[model samples]
Target: MNRRRIAVVTGSRAEYGLLAGLMRLLAADPRIELQVVVTGMHLEPRFGHTIEAIERDGFAIAARVPILEDGDSELASARSVGRAVIGLAEAFERLKPAMVVVLGDRTEILGAAQAAMLLRIPLAHIHGGEATEGAVDDMVRHAITKMAQLHFAAAEPYARRIIQMGEDPSRVHMTGAPGLDAIRDLRLKDAPELGAELGFPLEPGPLLLATYHPVTMDPTASVAGIEALLRALDRFPQARVIITGVNSDAGRDAVTGRIAAFSAGRANVLVKDSLGQVNYLSAMALAAAVVGNSSSGIIEAPALGVPTVNIGPRQGGRLRAASIIDCAEDDGAITDAIVRALDPAFRAGWPNPLSLYGQGDSAARIAAILAEAEPCLIKPFRDLGV
Candidate 1:
């Protein structure tokens, strides 16, 4: 019998990290053929050329399309999307996969979704229904939902939202967040071991892991927000911070540059382009609190029982867990939030968000359903109350 070919496209280190467990599951299935098409920051030199890490993880990439250029302006970002669409269309034509899977709402992933739509390849979108009101991702995510035939929502509310958007309820599955799978399954290193792996010593006091990406909608918030976060971190003399670089988005250079300059001579601060998934999560597992506007702090941190000091408007309107301490973009506001996160009473009473998303079985469920379910190439919109 011929195996069903499923093309999985990933555009960034963060997105690939979320898809890693599902990709591994699909690859292990005898009836399924997995094709990983890598693009975006994975190919960019400044982003650490993470495609090598993908291969090192034992997955053979079927294609590499360079979409990221050497600029972070809106015009450059627009051109990269155009390039992604053209490159992805050709990849689909060559591979001729039964279906395509994509996660999240990066501009590059948006291009892949459009290519799948024009190619008439069934597109399965994961993490589709959450809202990030401060970023263009909210718009792009809903747009991708309309194009995708299958929706693997991380939460039930998210699945319902997809159906509310005129999609057939039967095609939407609450598969939980796949990133949480790594939290439950991976043998994360302890503080000392992680320190050795990262070649940075772990502070005995509170450790804060931060990753801030540009809010594409606001554009100006990222750099200012990160600077405020740094000022906030300055207030906690005993607190240590480890920052991961921003994504390849418009105005990202400013955020990355500021983070580099801020961490230059700070003994307690460490900055890296990428730490891969395992190492980054290991750091998260050991950190006293997580800071910044990345989705990991909003989704995965709560599941891991860690406190998150989510600053700025980047994550505004996203569902919040009890452990999340949302604050403004001001330096004083961020300082207060971090101080709250480190509080023993707050940490002790923080609620787990596992019920809001799901347990660690999302990857297996998503892989199995894709292997067994027929391709949904022509889904007619199902209106609400139908």
Candidate 2:
């Protein structure tokens, strides 16, 4: 009785949080052997060395690929991807899993997809067919969709897009977003508890859970965007702001520098390297609004009944819920959006926090699918007769 081996690659802390639930299900399945590949920012100290968080979660990491190093230049990112390909190639060769699974569009996953394609290991992608027009990740996501033999999308619209891209319809599954599972299962900390944990007081004003990343399409957007965001945040002095670390993109250093500098003299602001999944989601559950361009604002916040002020184009072209207030990168625009998200009247009228993505059973669905899926690298282009 040979257990089906499934390899899942996680790069950053945020991506790991999304994949963790599915990884757990896969690990528990008697018919499955879960192979965990940790890489990228997880290995970087400045990003909280988040691989330890995965270890703490009890997932046995099969490979620790250190593809990222110091420096956030475009050249550095390109070199890192190259290293990921070489390293992941070797890992896949050694593990020889029936299928390789990866989530979303990231540089490391790009490398993973390439290696899997060349190695002839069946590839499955989660969170594919989503678009982020303002970021380079949009192209990467589409590229991965083509390479993957199995596509598990977070929503119907995303699944349709995956099919539109010539993927065989039978292979695509609308399994919802696994991120919501954390919100459903975790015993999230309440406001008082979260405040105590973060060493902040949640009384007297709104609490903002903010996470901003570099808009990779525009090199100058990160510095300018963080500056504008900081200025907008200054307007709401009564609010407590929790700013998390940026992704390991090309412009990360600029954004992190600005965020650190802004939080230095501000008592109302707290800067965290990584909140881990539980504390982060717990904070979101208690936040006045999830403020940032991070996808959490667009996906998980609505499910948690929290409003979101999504700034800039980093998450552009992705589906948004009624609770999300999109704004330009300008300080005035951001301030206005934040005001809208915090408005009691607005939330009062906002519909049932309609989860555009399905409910929280995504991880279980994906795990069952992976356990039963037949691994085959030979796929034919699907055509929809007009």
Candidate 3:
């Protein structure tokens, strides 16, 4: 019997981290053939040439699509997406897999979904139906949910949200998060090794792991918002912060500049271009709290029983575990949240064994479903009856 062919698209280091386990499971399964497509920041040097990380893990790269140029302006980003659409369409036609899998709300993923739609290929979307009102990702995620034939939601509410969006309930599955699956099966690196790899030392006292990205819809807010976060961290004299670089977005340069300036003579702060999954998860394990607008604080931090201080509109409406504390973009509010997160009493009360997003076996479940499901031909938008 011929094996089923499944293509997974990854645009950045973060998306690739979440999809890594799923790719491995599909690759190892005797009944499925995995086709990995790399694009977006993975091809950029500033993001640490993330494609090398993927290849280092032994997964085969079936195609490499270069969609993003050195364009950070809004029009430039849109043009990049247009270019990606053409490249992805050609690649999908050549590969012709039974289904294309895309994760999260990055524009590149959306471009891939659009390509798959135009080519009449089935799309399997992960992390859909969750809201992120702070940025345009909320809209992109929902749009992909509608375009997708199969939905693997991270949490139950997310799964229900997909159904509420007029998706066939039978087609949506609560598969938790593939990122959490890595935490379950993989042993994290030690703090010293992690620090050395990222070219920083792990300081004593409470730790704050921060990752911020530009809000594509509100680029102006990026700089001020990050400034507020840095000022808030300044109030915590006993705490050390580890800052990860921003994504390749419109206002990313501004945010990166602010982070560089803030980390300049501070012995308590370390900023890095990127930290692979191992170091990232290890940092999460060691940190007293995570402070940033990144989705990792909302989705992955809860699984580790760590407190997450989610700042600003970037992750505005996403479902979060009890471990997260949402604060507005104000230095005072962020400082208060950090103080509260470090309180032992407050940390003890945080909900553990929280399965808001499934039980970490999402990869196996997603793969099993994909292996058994039949692909459907794409229909007209009018036929969708939305």
Candidate 4:
């Protein structure tokens, strides 16, 4: 009846929000000893030092590993990854967990996966086999899938992709996207309440919740894309905009700089470094349209029955619900997409949009699997006999 020690590594606010439900379940399970390892943006001040959010949620942080360099260039991202691998390896060595859990395709998460692999600790990867073609996440995600002994894909197509990647079929589970669990479980605040918390009025116009991240594959596009989005927002002068901070990716500084300039002295626009998880979901729940290239627009926004204007190729290859409108990273295209998302006819057309990921039960399933499943250091590649 000895409990298994499973360490979960989270490096960003978004990743932490998705992993929070699973972590809570793991911590509650009598047969599991949950170890929380905070790193990357969680340790960086510019990204809001979100490790405080984890501590506020009452989880004991087993380790704090600062792995980011001082810049947002490609070289900085590479150096950060290098630092992450070494720092996370040392932390894993101290925790000595039976398995390590990671979510998504961030470079820091990749480092954690590598560290776990080199240390011979079985790894469990969530959101595996998904693609973000415009960013380097596509490569990092698949790499982690290959390294992991247990794979929890967010959807059937993703599970199939993981199997196609030569992972053992038995090890892959379609647990849905843990992001949706927050939408289902949390009592989302109403528009007025959310507005009060955000220090803005949600009324007098449509509310747009927007977030943008760097397209690491094209560094120059980050600034240009944010500029286009800002221009598009200008077309809707009456709309209230909430632009969240950029992630700590390559070219992040450029995007953040552009957003800051755009929001400055604009009474209709608000910029926030971190809204945490609750306020974010509340805003999404009440938004006229979720506008951005962030995956939350694809996964969580549609699940909340909110239309998403997903700009550019950043989210290419992920499953798209009818509620999502894909557009190029141009002001004209983005503005048109936002227009469609706000049309009452368009919103009514897809009432109760089917969630392709799952029914918000991902965390429980993932927690149960981790509690009972045996972790192996070696996984023989499964071929399709092709």
Candidate 5:
């Protein structure tokens, strides 16, 4: 049988982790030929040469389009997107894929989808119809939703929102968050062993795992927010802290600079560009509390039955589990939230915590849908209610 050729794009390590299970599913299925498009931070050395990480997973990349060039400013980022659109369109023309599957909200996917749209290739998007009030990806995600022919939401409400935006309800599928696929299927390493692997030596005390990004709504506050979080963390002098680097946002310099300078001599702190997917998820599972503006605190932590102290407005309007403690981006507020998340009495209340997302089998469902949804030119705008 001539398999359906589907092209997949991954630009960063984080989204690659989320898409891991589904990629494997499509690769092994006899009906789908996976065309991997690798770009963005994956090709950059500073972000950890993540393309190598992707290759290590046994998928042969079909295209390596380099678009970024020292993206330290907004103009550079815009130019990079233009380059991506041009490069990605060429990739689409060559591959002639039946469909293009892109995930999450990032410049990489946005530009890739633009290329697919102009080439009249079918586009499928994941993690659509959600809100992230403080970040730039909020707008990026909605834009991708408009371009997509099929939408896979991690939650039901998100699916409804896509329909509200005039997308056909039939094209929207609630398959849950793919990030949990690793949590449910992978054997996450325990604290002491993971600590040894990460070189952090997580002692017998509370561990705070955090990853903060630049809030597009107010870039200036990104630095101040991290400072407040660090000050709050300082209150727990015995706490073991593991911090991953910031994403490629305009004002990211301030956040990483603060982290590097603050953690320079702190014996209890460890900072890195990345810990890979397995090590990172293992760290999350073993952590005393997941802290920061990351959506992981909202989606992954609750599923792991771990407490989350979500600081600031980055994840402002997203659906959350009952175990989440939301607080302003202030030292006192963050400190108190962390304290509350660590309280035994509060922890006792969530003996059977549940995720608002999914049961972690989204990959198989997504793969099946992609193999069947062939490319087309006539995608009439789906009405608001029909």
Candidate 6:
């Protein structure tokens, strides 16, 4: 019996967290061969050289496609995507994997999917049909959905959405969010340990684990939005604000600059390039409230029984848990939402675990499905509902 080779592409640190469990399961499966490709910010030193994290976890990296350049301009972002497309195409051609697995709505994933489509390799897409109307990622995600041969949606509603988008129902699987699987299974470090590791004192006041990324569609608003969020943070002087770095997108400089400016005099505020999944979840567990536009606050934070004050439009239309409080980019609204999120009454009514993303077995299910499913000829634009 020949081992079926599957290529998994991880572009950023966040996406890698989502894919790590699935990669581990695939690596352990006797019938499957996992080819991991690290790209985008994973190659950058500023992002904690996250490719080392991948290797540290004992998975062999099949390829590392360097696409990000120093400049944080729109042209640089576009060129990064183009370079990823070229590099990914060359990789897929050389490896000739049975399928290429791409996740989320990043530009690098879009480039990889396009490359796979052009190379005539079947594509397996994860987390499709979810809406993020705030950024260009929404468009990129939907485009990848159309190009993919197999879809693994996080929720039933998302699965239905993919079917509605003309994908064959049989080709789409509701495997829940793989990210949640890691969250559910992993034994996170204690608050003290996590704080020591992160080199920040764990104070008793409201702990805010915030992560903001550049909204590529609203390039001008990116810097302004970070400043607005910083202003909001200023209002919560008692709270310890822990901010993760921005994603590798256009205008990242603006986001980083604001963080640096805010951190200059604030002893309670700490900034990090990347927080590994374990530390991230540990922080979420201890946090009084999560404040940011990152999907983690929208999806994973709620599952941990933590309140999330989601600032701005980046994660607008996605399914949110009861713990999330949506707010605009305005500083006043963000500050008000933080107050609401930290309220005792609001924190008392947290949603149950089952109502959240998944049951924590998504990786096993995804691995089993990939192992058993026959590689059928995928016809583009075949409406399943029709």
Q: Against the true structure, candidate 3 has what lDDT?
A: 0.86
lDDT of 2 at 239: 96
Q: Per-residue lDDT for 158-277 in model 1, tens only?
A: 988999898888899999999889888888888888888887888686888988888788887777887888888888778778999898889998988888888989998889899889
Worst 10 residues of 5 by lDDT: 377-386
Candidate 1: regions farther than 4 A off: 352-355
Please identify which of the two predictions, 1 or 2, would achieve the higher TM-score against the true structure.
Answer: 2
lDDT of 6 by residue, 304-339 (tens): 788898988889888988888999989999999999
Q: What is candidate 5's lDDT per residue for 148-264, written digit by digit as tens?
A: 899999999999998888887778899999998889888889888898787778877788898888877788889889999988988998999998978887777788899999898
Lowest-lDDT window of 10 residues in candidate 1?
347-356
Residue 207 CA error for candidate 2 (Å)?
A: 0.1
Quote each prediction's TM-score.
Answer: 0.98, 0.98, 0.95, 0.98, 0.97, 0.97
C-alpha lDDT (0 to 100) for residue 213 of candidate 1: 86
**lDDT of model 2 at position 67:** 95
Q: For candidate 6, give the lDDT of residue 161.
A: 93
Which segments of model 4 are wrong by more than 4 Å? none
Estimate the TM-score for candidate 3. 0.95
CA lDDT scores, all candidates in order = 0.89, 0.92, 0.86, 0.92, 0.88, 0.88
Which regions of candidate 3 deviate over 4 angstroms?
378-386
Pick out the ten consecutive residues of candidate 3 with the lowest summed lDDT.
Answer: 377-386
- What tens-digit string does per-residue lDDT give for candidate 2 at 93-154? 99999999999999999999999999999999999999998899999999999999999999
TM-score of 5: 0.97
TM-score of 1: 0.98
Q: Is candidate 4 or candidate 6 better by TM-score?
A: 4
lDDT of 4 at 318: 95
